[model samples]
Target chain A: MSVLAFIDQSEGQVKKGAYEALSYAVKLASQLGTTAEAVVLGKLTDDIAALGKYGVKKIYHVADEQLNHLDAQVFADVIAQVARAAGAKIIVLSNNSDGKAIAPGLSVKLKAGLVSGAVALPDTGNGFTVKKSVFSGKAFAHVAIKTDIKIIALNPNSFSITEAGGGNAEVSAFAAAVNTPKVKVTAVNKVKGDVPLGEAEVVVSGGRGLKGPENWGMIEELAKLLGAATACSRPVADTHWRPHHEHVGQTGLAIAPNLYIAIGISGAIQHLAGVNRSKTIVVINKDPEAPFFKAADYGIVGDAFEVVPGIIEEVKKLKGVA
Target chain B: MKILVCISKSPDTTAKIAFTDNNTKFATDGVQWIINPYDEWYALVKAIEIKEKDPSAVIHLVTVGGADVEPVIRKALALGGDEAIRINADTPDSYYVACQIAETAKQGSYDLVLAGKETIDHNSASIGGMLAELLELPYVSLATKLELNGNTVLITREIEGGEESCEVNTPVVVSCQKGMAEARIPNMRGIMAARTKPLKVVEPVAADSFTGIVSFELPPAKAGVKLIPADNPAELVRVLHEEAKVI
Candidate 1:
């Protein structure tokens, strides 16, 4: 009985959340007195064996090019088969879009009890209970999975990543019958950018206070300097100050990163509902009483035009750039 | 196109969160219940848009809650849903709720299932995924934009670091969030039409529950905001490093 983690990949590269999930699965496996193993569903350019540094002992790779693009039904069926083959009592996945899409189906297929958005390690003294945020991060509930097979989707950045001396994991190819999805892709729309928000450890988000689309360059600059993704408040996107794709809120994207920097945002309750799970928050605004400051771990009361440039400069300095 | 839009009754977004009975359950007293905002803003609006594109399209509002939630169901009907179904039971768990919904969807033979990414009350974003699984349908969550052409549905969803676009066949499940569309209020004509619309209540089929919530509690109160002098931004950084240890 081992812990099985699904390592998500895109375009033959491992996604950042996969690393976080691997780290988390390692801890969960240790607690369960078992080993951690990974299951990859697509062709990957990255060295799968080197993932052993994340503490997984073995990797099961399904290197079919057809599996590259996520087809939830096919992916879930294949993952359920892999979980059964590996004797994974506990299956872990990163609670991002793809995981959310497939987990419930996989759970039902495997008759496994699932806990999504798990924030902490399970309490195993009595029954196997995991804690998860409820009410949009306003509360928490301890859910005890009664099924023999259990599934957990860990929130991004909830667990710290630790690397140690590694074993080059043994990799074996597994083949399963694939189901062709009824949905066929006629065209692909890719948002060209340096980093995707879901993969960024650092994120810089702007709000209405940025004023207009033209001023967005500074936010982007800061994000580029920190190697982070750029995001926006709902109003900013609604007003077309930023693309709708960049919006984040209760009704938008829910992101939890290692460091989240909010600029010119008032921290509306709705907006806070989405990102309060971030490990560390920094707010920059000229308004001293912006609601975002209350939740921010660090605050700078200055105009974005002035403060954001300062931040960009500081990051460059930290990186040993002139 | 047939769209099944799922709505849940949750406390208004600004309500102060509190628990009852030694923190075992959420306190409902004096709390104003509203349509789960995400559903109101995203799912319902998108459904309305689909109906607009095809006047012959049917939109049904579905909920799994006690009878007290009927008014919300009627409100959804007013907001352009052609009919409503209330599964008469408390949504005890994600599994139970998904089973009830999947059973209803199967019987109705709906072409599409729409829901909010998560209910603001429990914040468990599992029902859509669970229902999709139970029905053996494709599922997408946090969809900001959706377009349907022939039998294929194109959806754009928000992910952690970026957005993903996928094309899936009809009979798929989608959970909506902010960018799907702006919420629309019922005009007088729609409001009047809703009173005449049928709202059918049915008993939920029994299903095995694999998990239970032991208790619920509010997050610890945030510490009082610490203020640093506006002129001393450098000192604020110092406090972040030494006091908050967040830098």
Candidate 2:
């Protein structure tokens, strides 16, 4: 039995989380005393052999042009076929958008036990149990998979990426029957942002305390200075001060960044659920009693108008940017 | 067109989360259950919008749980569903829940299946894809916007950085999230009418769950915040750089 990691890519470029999944699969493979391999669909622009840095010994490339865009059904079918052919006892992938789309379908196709948003490695010592965040990171659950074939989709940033000693993975072209896609892609609109929120190391978010969209200049300036992505609270989005896509909360996007700066936002439990996983939280609010301060690692009890601009100047001074 | 809308009960957004039974089950004493917002506000509301356009469209709400879920189901009916069905099982296993939902959808032969992207409690976000696979139908996930055009449906779903527009024929599954539809509260007339709505209780079909929860854990509590006075905003940046090292 082998462990197979499905690499997710966009526009021929590998996603940041794919490497983490590959590394995870490699570690799991060693735990199971099996070999680790990778499978990549769609044509690629990057060197597939270089993925060996993640410790996978071999990779199966199905360079199909039709597989470029995500068709969850087709992707699941191809991965299932490859997993069956390779005698894969375990399959690993990212729990990002693409992985979420594919893993569930693949589990059904293979009748394998599946765990999504797994935050840690499986406890193989105790019947292959996996720990995952539940209730929007408010809690964690240890789930045991009972099936022989298991699939795990790791939450992005949950596992660190460890590079192997050094070697190129043997890249072999594998052919599988690609089914016609039931979902037809009409258009792809890439939201051009300075930094994608999901991949952003630092995030500066605003709330209703900004007062209006007009006051958002300082928020943007602070985010720009910090090289961070900008986000907003649900009320800001609901009031049309920001786009719904920028909203981060229980009902919105859940992000896990290294540094999260909240300005003018009262930390509600719902909002905290979305972002509690962030490594370091900084809250700037006029109200010292704001619940957000409790969760913040560092808090400034001040007005965003006064505090944000002051912080911006300080950051500029620290970074030596005029 | 027949639309099967899957709804689930979740703790109110502000409800305090705790576990009981050796951390194996969620604590429910004094907790209030409501329809999951994504399911109620987005999935069910959007289905109601479709039915508004075409009165022939039938929206049936389905939930998997014991009698406790019926109240939440009734609220969904009040919003606009024609009826509700309760699968008599209370399991945390998402695969089992998906199996139960698939069985109902198959028997109904619905042309469309809609569900929230994920329930707020477990947040597995897998039912739509799993159900679509089991039914051998197309699946579109995390859809922010959707419109029905004859037999084909136009959808806009959130990707990693941006969004993608796609088209799929009916007999498809979609998991709805924010921006799909506006949330609505049940008015007096709607609430009264909901009382008469058909609520069928069905026994679960034989299905094996491949996963089980062994235990639950709460994340470590955050250390108390380190406060910085308003006058020393620059000090905050200094600490972030030299101490926190985030800047």
Point to the candidate with the largest DockQ.
Answer: 2
Root-mean-square deviation of every model? 2.2, 1.3
Which residue pairs in model 2 clash with each other?
Answer: none
The fraction of reference A/B contacts recovered in model 2 reads 0.82
Q: Highest TM-score: give the candidate number.
A: 2
How good is the docking of model 1, by CAPRI class? medium
Q: For candidate 1, write residues B1-247 as lDDT tens digits.
A: 8899989998887777788888778888888888998888899989999989999899988999998998888878888888999999877678888999998899889889999988886777888888888998888877889999898889887654456777887889998987888867889998899999999999999988888787776666556455554555556545544665544
Clash count of each predicted structure: 10, 0
What TM-score quantifies how close candidate 1 is to the native fold? Answer: 0.94
- Tens digits of per-residue lDDT for model 2 on A28-120? 998889899999999999999999988999899888887998889999999998999999999999988889899999999999999998999
- Deviation (Å) of A112 in candidate 1: 1.2
Which DockQ values do the candidates obtain, in the order shown?
Answer: 0.55, 0.82
All candidates' lDDT scores?
0.82, 0.91
lDDT by residue (B1-247, candidate 2, tens digit) is 9999999999998888899998988899899999999999999999999999999999999999999788899888888989999999977587898999999999999999999999898888899999999999988999999999999999999887788999999989999999999888989899999999999999999898989999999999988899999888888998888898888
lDDT of 2: 0.91
Residue B58 displacement (Å), model 1: 1.3
List the candidate 1 regions with Cα displacement exceeding 4 Å.
Answer: A186-193, B159-161, B232-247
